[model samples]
Target: MIETAILTPLEEELFALVNALEQFGFKKHKSLLGSLEIFEFHELNLLLALGGHGKTQFGVQSQYLLCQLPQVELLICAGAAGALSNELEIGDIVAATATVEHDYNLKFVNRPLPRFTGTPQVIDTLKQLPRTEWDFRLHFGLIASGDEDVVTVERGQELAYLTGCVAVAWEGVGGARSSQFAQKQYVELRGITDTANHCAAADFEVNLASAMFNLAKLIVRWQAAKDYCAV
Candidate 1:
């Protein structure tokens, strides 16, 4: 069984993906968390939840879902992100090999870097999937996560230099940390929605829908190929 979490309810890509799966007999359920929405794909033993936005919410909801759905064998955190690398373009997809909390720091003492590497088995599984023909490219790399949206090119460059990350987002590291603590297999896939610049908001607005849709499509494709129903 697989458990998937996204950050927001208003995300059209997620909404479309869930609705499409519903036609295949997936059932929606009410969740205990106010910001969360639950959907079950009985045939595939898949559970989907909306974890709300931000790092804290993602971490809390990931733990809650993991505890509540102990039967799930894998956890996927999928959403949109800003490209930190010049190689990345809007609407491209990134399957994170590792995640780092770039905004985390100690007040005065030197703290170990907050980096979480995803389960290798899960990462390998994703890497082995057959590539589908799509307009956007798929990349495997590190992703930096933080509470603030990176808006300047210089800031983006600094983060990439620090973490060697190709993209940045608000919640992937939270989910990664939660999954690590639970000892659950986890993977994160982010679709690029902007280039992290002065024009980030405008670029994000233009690319968000397409990026989200593509991410959902990739998930659905992987589930189908794995014959999730039988597993």
Candidate 2:
């Protein structure tokens, strides 16, 4: 049975992890979901799927993957995020214990914005991991998810204020939503590629490689340190 499924949002992001996983014998295969890229490693009964580029894309693909791969007990959302906190440096990771769907607000309709949280076991596992294995730092905080590009400091701060997030990304809420619906364990580990400032987009392009590599390296390190499938 496939015990874990890793859903990543971009081709570059997927390859960064796949390249890292190759040393452990993971290999590409014909995807059951034809539109998605799939990889498998038999010994661990692990699978990875390319979930496409945005929140909507990720939600649709992940929901389908969970339905088709019912044995998958854990879902991981991995990729890059813009830092909303001043302390975050490029290549740092925000292993969010909680996340907010900032764009899902309904204040006009008299409803509150939704927040997603939990996965304490996963947090504990990551916390107990050997720091020597990773070159980057880990920060546990709230991650804000929405469709906004968040290229300006003003906008980023606004999101940070509204959602109380340390990092902002396009796909975390969708990832969490899918896991919630599937009733599976979930966690999101995102690499900080750029600070959400005026130069955010340009900065993201410049730092993308290192951030993704570090993030992918962390995943491989985590897998080796703990048997996520067992508990």
Candidate with top TM-score is: 2
Following a full C-alpha superposition, what root-mean-square deviation does model 1 have from the true structure? 3.0
lDDT (10s digit) by residue, model 1, range 106-161: 78988866888877876776677777677778899999988887999899999999
**TM-score of candidate 2 against the unseen true structure:** 0.90
Per-residue lDDT of candidate 2, residues 1-231 (tens digit): 778888888887887767766755656564656566688866545788887677898889999888988888888898889999998999998998987888885655766577778489989888887788677899999998888888888898888887788999988888889999989988888999999888888887788778877876677667776765457
- Candidate number achieving the greatest lDDT relative to the actual structure: 2
The true-versus-predicted C-alpha distance at residue 166 of model 2, in Å, is 0.5
- Estimate the Cα RMSD of every predicted model relative to the unseen true structure: 3.0, 2.2
Candidate 1: where are CA atoms >4 Å away? 1-13, 19-35, 228-231
